[model samples]
Target: MNIKKTVEKIPGGMMLAPLFLGAVLHTFWPGTGKYFGSFTNGMITGVVPILAVWLFCMGASIKISATGTVLKKSGTLVATKIATAWVCAFVFAQLLPEGGMVKTGFFAGLSVLAIVAAMD
Candidate 1:
């Protein structure tokens, strides 16, 4: 199967694929998480350069002309989405009893991204 095509066609599948694979890998390997944690310092160091490049690329892509109008609309949409996500997360966290780790993290990250993306 063409994974890229599958990911593009199915909504949320792209995100789910990595998550499912990680779960499966954890289940099968068991010790992979421990090994992964052991190598975290190296991973953190390596990620700095990659993150810097990403930020530079993103900064380069920003358009000066459409800043005002685009930012206004995008900010409103982002705020709405963040509010909805927060409500859903709170509800799920209360109902689950297990404490919705994924949902909570997702909503938290989404809120942060929205604020950053909407910033002037």
Candidate 2:
């Protein structure tokens, strides 16, 4: 079986496939990565290398001159996403007796995670 061919079958597989595999490994054997050496642990920790390269490429490819245009195009989506998130957070906060999002709901700790991970 061609590894390249198999990976190519899944979109973004070059990046995501390995991530899924690692997640599965962790699910079966939690903290397995910590037992590995520093290098392996670092790589497994969060796919930092791939993330760095992805960020670098994303920034590097954008021409400074078109930055305004890029921002303009993305600004709408970003603003909308943030606005909706804030609205939801406000509503959720109101629901909570503490007047805040700390630990509540069937999804205990979910509100905090959602707010923290909310993206632009």
Candidate 3:
């Protein structure tokens, strides 16, 4: 099997297909979690498989990109995006209502994690 051909096809197959299927599933099975013990657990379980697949794909992509320049450029872009997102989240958290349920520090940490994960 040609890996390059398979990778090229992934934009339509792995990417769009999952997005379309997710939309369809969400539309048809909306509120299906209410029947489960806890909505949070049900939601997590439903999404875990997708998340696993995404992580595997990400690992594969990184493995295939052995070029130092490509890695450096990708790292810079990811860092910039993550820094921007973190600043935005921090600013938004600070501006939130006094009684807001979100903790500013927690959100900042989450933003950092998002950036770290993207780099990985």
Candidate 4:
């Protein structure tokens, strides 16, 4: 299959595809990373280095003059995410019982902590 072309066809597909695959892998076979003794284990478990490289690449790709623009855009995105999360938590708090949890129903076992964590 032409992975590059396929990924390019969808917006943000390049990043999303790998993330989806990783989530599936973790969901179905959580031990796969530890089961692999060498490079596979490192590739799965050693995310910090990979994240550092990705962050470095992202930062490196931006022009020096666009630093302010990047900062402003990222700041706005972060603020929006926090605001949205807060609003969601507040709404959930109102929907949930006084203990801030759903005890019985389709949403059983859900709590404010879970909502906040999912939002974050």
Candidate lDDT scores, in order, read 0.59, 0.73, 0.62, 0.84
Candidates' RMSD to native: 12.8, 6.2, 9.4, 6.5
For candidate 1, report its TM-score.
0.33
Q: Which ranges of candidate 2 are over 4 A from the true structure?
A: 1-45, 99-120
Model 4 deviation from native, Cα RMSD in Å:
6.5
Q: What is the lDDT of candidate 2?
A: 0.73
- What local lDDT score does residue 111 receive in model 4, on the 0 to 100 scale? 98
Q: By lDDT, who's the top model here? A: 4
- How many steric overlaps does candidate 1 have? 0
TM-score of each: 0.33, 0.48, 0.37, 0.60
* Backbone clashes under 3 angstroms, per model: 0, 0, 0, 0
For model 4, how many clashes?
Answer: 0
TM-score of 3: 0.37
**Tens-digit per-residue lDDT, 2-66, candidate 2:** 99799989998877887788788878977776898676666667677657866787789899999
Question: What's the best-to-worst order under TM-score?
Answer: 4, 2, 3, 1
- Please list all clashing residue pairs in model 3, or write none if there are none: none
* Two-way lDDT contest, 1 vs 2, winner: 2
Give the Å shift of residue 40 in candidate 1. Answer: 6.2
